[model samples]
Target: MKKKSIVSMLVAFYLAFGVLFSSVSAKIQSEQAFDNKIVKRLKVNNIYNHIEALSKEPRVAGTEAEWKAVQYIKRQFDSYGYESELQPFTFIEYKAPTKVSVNVNGDTVAAAPFTYTPNGDVNGELDYIGLGTPDDIKGKDLTNKIALIKRGEITFGEKVINAANAGAKAVIIFNHLSGELNGTLGNVDNRFVPTIAMTKEQGDILVEKLNSGDVLSASITIAGSVIEEKTSHNVIAKKDVTHKQKDTNQVIVIGAHYDFVPTSPGANDDASGTAVTLELARVLAKVPTDTEIHFITFGAEELGLIGSNKYVDSLTDVEIDRIVGMFQLDMVGSKDAGELVMFTVDGEKNLVTDLSAAAGVRTGTPLTYGQEGRSDHVPFYYAGIPAALFIHSPTEPWYHTPEDSLDKISKEKLLETAKIVGSAAYQIARPDTPALERAKVAPKEVDYEKMTGGLK
Candidate 1:
């Protein structure tokens, strides 16, 4: 009787274990099947070719080159059978001064004009104000005087505004360090006075002279500095739900900025991202999905996220509520950069990071997330959408430099990024996946770390 009971218990345990194993295996296979739809269709050469075409020259915002890039991107989208639209918007472009001169005590001082500094020619008594804070210049008469300020504790713009409010005629901000101060006032401010930046060495000499009770007169002249309105564009292509009967009423945004700095070819600093976005759109064009997706490439991102901000601001409340996640690809294919990482504005895990992290693991390269902001994802995050930036950290040495050319791009990195992002986005859009709620489905937890460095 004892031997019969033991045999029956063993048989029951074996059957239960077999059932569990089969279920797990089926789940893995299901996920793989979905992933294959994206990875198998991704052609790295297509991505590389797009990068080569776009990065041949600098696509500076509001310039003919940028306009050409926009048209090129639109044409590519149209070729993919998606109805692409060029959303036009205007921004203020600041033209640097052609002639900037600063003379003090019959001696010339080397200086550079700040961006958006209004052209002015004035001579005034040079007064030393520490840091140019309101408290530093409190109760002091600086009428028609040039406020000599140090560069620390406040922005160059704030310092100039403080001195201007105190009736100063001009401002000179010297760096706290050795290099030249290439600073901007951020935007056009009516109260901003004519501002110029100088090295710390030159500023120290002026400070010593003023401290020694020596009277000093200074002249500042800036010419040809102009601020004008210019137009830029955002290319938008939408992929509506493939299965209306299973519509989830949710949306996902995949975006990148196509505009480059004035000097950079931007092959990695975001032509890589743009190419990946284009490729994903092509691959997913016919994929069956129940959620809507919008693939966008923005302009004037180097000009402070203007294009993305404009795009987000145009969304109505209803549209904003429908967006569940945003994946912003930037600098994803640099050969010299460190490992890939996702960055969120708040340094916390959200839906976008969770899905991508899981996708990364399934693709055989688990990802880590960090905290960062300076990308197109910022506007979407500010709009109460779950957004994350996908990029390689400890960015390449060529970032934002002329060396950011096609030779530095890595096809392997581009393919890996596309697979991860494409799968993650499709995970949300796929009909099998349930409606995504913010942090509703906890993804397999992956390692998290702080960003190692910034984009140079």
Candidate 2:
């Protein structure tokens, strides 16, 4: 009986010590948390106003409009009381063709120029190369001919390269189904010849004429395709840690691409994203936290993520590791787009997805996670940092078109996206306390189903 009493007393004392120590080590929270303050400060009208101002023109990279947009973003950051800088990088900027056409035996057909296609005028006998795969190009005499290829089975770039190797003067890729074909030669290349796209119907008629032994001659002209070195800018704003002694060197990066495809206003493609970043920076500027949050808007995303890639490449191995999480917003305010979804580069869930899922649950707009790597988040993810792209899937029909105007932006969508991201960022940035009750961040129960979708 005496030994049992001694053991029970020691166990009780140990439990009391554990509880006291945990209480002392945890952060203290008020009835309302910092995220609440952030959310309250976020106004949909401000986001909409910003979007309206930004989407007024086509902000293509390396253009006067692009530079104007960059300055505006930087100014907004400065007005929000954050130090902002423009980081410039050089790239071979490709100019969209102003004039493109194909004439078959004097019958002119409308054509679209592929990206990075050199400006040229070529006259040759048109030959059909199905799909334009390597197998299709081999053993075929395409000397001085214009290769008419179909859009399927392989990339437009591959077809162009294959035709070039076969001594073709130019390439004409037609859509596999209906409507006009719009594509790229993948990237800037010295081997790139004049490449253009046409409707499937136009290609079918040309093939029929060739197969019927009708002597066919075609003329292809692509004008205004300039390849020259140009500078693109990235706007970055930093929110310093509120508590120096308690500072966690870990940084949170929230980014969005501020550039758009040529001729597109990009209200939904990313003016929505850029507006959200600015708003978040404005709200979080006054919030006290032990973590640093960096808000950045990248340029030249439509040109294959050049801006984001450069930013990540500039970071040292140690600096890369210091980044705890990155949230990228793209196309987040379109009413016609699919619901909000978080995407990781490897299609796997990480800390970013976890916090977003929890935030979604709290905000009543639960988000789902999936896999994709076609945006600014890719570079950070590739560097082994936790990053996720916050975008609406199934994108609006106006994506990358002249129709992507301010009318497509939904204010509610912007608010919801901003709310979820702001809450999630605060979850990691709030002061670390000894317990959940005293923590500056509101304790949220993570919904795994919403985060991982019950996947492995």
Root-mean-square deviation per candidate: 5.6, 7.9
Best by TM-score: 1
Cα deviation of 84 in candidate 1 (Å)? 1.9
Instruction: Provide TM-scores for the models.
Output: 0.85, 0.70
Report the lDDT tens digits of candidate 2 across residue range 222-288. Answer: 8987779989999999998888877777688999998998788889989999999999999888777
Task: Give per-residue lDDT, candidate 1, residue 241.
Answer: 93
Query: What is the number of backbone collisions in each predicted candidate, taken in the order shown?
Result: 0, 9
Q: Report the number of backbone clashes for model 1.
A: 0
Candidate 1 lDDT by residue in tens digits, 1-456: 899999999999998988877775565567767899999999999999999999989999999999999998999889988999999999999989999999998899999999989999999999999998989999989999999999999888899999999989999999999988999988899999999999999999999989999999999999998899999999999999989998878789999999999878999989999999999999999799999999999999999999999999999888898898999999999999999999999999887887788778778778999999999999999999999999998999998899999999999999999999998898889987777655323233322221101101
